[model samples]
Target: MLSGFSSHWHYLWLVAASLIAGVMNAMAGGGSFLSFPAMLSMGILPVQANATNTVALWPGQLTSLAALKSDLRKDLLPVAALASILGGLTGAEVLLRTRQVTFLHLIPWLLLMGAVIFGISGPVSRWLRARSAEPHAKRTPRYFPLFCALFPVCFYIGYFGAGGGFLIMTVLALFGVDEMHALNAMKIVTACLSNLVAIITFIVRGAVLWHYCLISMVFAALGGYIGARYARRMNPDVLRRIVVLTGCVISAYFFWRQY
Candidate 1:
């Protein structure tokens, strides 16, 4: 148990972390990169921290989704939603079955992969735009193939979810959904669904730290609002770079500690 001062400091730290996470999530897609470490630093166990992080960041995701509701409705695809929900359920089940040691071992690789994906997002986006502009270029393949591709991405989101939004945006872009706002909207919806299933599983299994989750959620939502309001002034490329750097540093630190 924490002493009074320690407890106060922990909460303060969490509030600051969640607020940054919300801004990062709104600007780019790496909120988990902040919130997860914050919890771990507070002596929360890995599994509990993951569960609590999901719950804490969930409300901010919902807020983003609400803001993007119009765009989502305009370009929403049923198959994508179905794939995300199904994959998320499967991934959450897998996470529940995982041992703490195993999850600790996996964290570095997951973070590395998320970082690589985020780092390449800009180039990938540019390439997609170029391809889309070409004459007689194919926009998207068939629904089955797209569904298959999105399933694993959603599964990852359910399991760890650090940079899942970048992956989702890439997939959507490949599917010929080139509008930035639409892509972001779809990313938020898919992420929200993935977290929804995982949070339910965490709740059922008694894994979530509800008090911390509640505190982070409120602050994260506030951050999301602030980020959205100031989005025009923020550079997404800079934010993406920061997220990539943070992911690499965190991954390296965890790797060293665990190994």
Candidate 2:
């Protein structure tokens, strides 16, 4: 255990951080960028930070899932759960096999692309909004196919989770899922799979700091709960814009620094 009152202070900081992470995660997926860095700066070892962050994410996921329990009933829950399990396992396996060095090379390009896509999200949403009065039946075939194609997005979420929310939102929209439900369900399930699988894998590899993970998880859960509660009151369009802008800035930084 951490000595003195510093441990409690750490917990408090983590709680606040988790709250921010939860909000960002519920609204987008790049919340890790914040939480991970915070942990690193707090003197957590690199591997420990990663494992702890993943573990902490669990609370947030559970919170989000609980909030959406009603809508996630019937066939949806089972299928989504199955998908998360399978996809998360695959992603963890891939992460294990791959070297972080490879990602270093790709980060720049990925960020640039993310920025471009974010820049266009507003116009895309506007176009869709204009068509709100039209029968969406005609667009089903084209859109559904595009959405299904994004199943691989889960793999990436499991691997990194940098901007998985943006990808999910974009893909879900293409498939014609309503914005709010998709955001809620996607955040919860994705977090479940990504965090659980990664935590298991990292633990087996001896990559975790159990004390830190426990502390972070506790706070992150609190954050996620508060975030979900807050999201319930916000406008999707407004939240989306904020997420997009933030994503663009992150992507730009990656592009310039890594590329």
Candidate 3:
């Protein structure tokens, strides 16, 4: 649908980008930072870029779901999906009602903070893991705070998802969900819900680039499938480092350019 690139060349890039995006999304959460920028650089405008990126990411979620259907904890999915969907809807309404230029100015700083928080997550998690073996009763108050904590984060994802994966990972960690496969599963489901709402809102506003979305979804799906299949094979810690570094660089680039 996107003219200029030959079918063969475009498909290659599509698969490459989607693969990168799927792996990044599963491992960290900022896959959009990669896919969105790539789209923009290829000539799509901001609004269209956002819409197309949301649609593109759906496939990644689907792929992840298919790959991890067995390992998924069904109990958490309903609540996470509800929270993400409701928050996303609210975010879309707020975005529709407000001016976004102010938020754009704030994105880099927010992403930088997210990156820093994510970077220390490993160490903090290690420390927490050290303080082990508490009674189940004692842990309730310790971990229960995280469900309510997602308010601002999921709302932001619905509004703008740049560093959302980082936020999701952080929230999951807080809630005592530490396994990468489980976390990835949660991310995929929650993201799917969030993006579904955002995509609908964007479509109503006529913001989506259908051609770009169509092409990108195919690649993103494939990438997500591959990542899901091989998720257990890679070192999750290394993947986390790569994602954090990417977020830091992207945040810095935007901060320098805009500020």
Output the TM-score of candidate 3. 0.72
Ten contiguous residues minimizing lDDT sum, candidate 1: 132-141
RMSD of each: 2.6, 5.3, 4.7
Model 2 lDDT at residue 228: 61
Task: Give the higher-TM-score candidate: 1 or 2.
Answer: 1
- Give the top-scoring candidate (TM-score): 1
Q: What total of clashing residue pairs does each candidate reach?
A: 0, 1, 1
Pairs that collide in candidate 1 are none
Q: How would you encode candidate 3's per-residue C-alpha lDDT over 33-136 as one tens digit per residue?
A: 57765665556655456566777786566655677667665667656766787788887667655544665566577668757766776776565454433322
Q: What is the TM-score of each candidate against the true structure?
A: 0.88, 0.65, 0.72
lDDT of each: 0.81, 0.60, 0.67
Q: Tell me the lDDT of model 1 at 85.
A: 87
* Model 1 alpha-carbon miss at residue 60, Å: 1.4
Worst 10-residue lDDT window for candidate 2 reads: 138-147
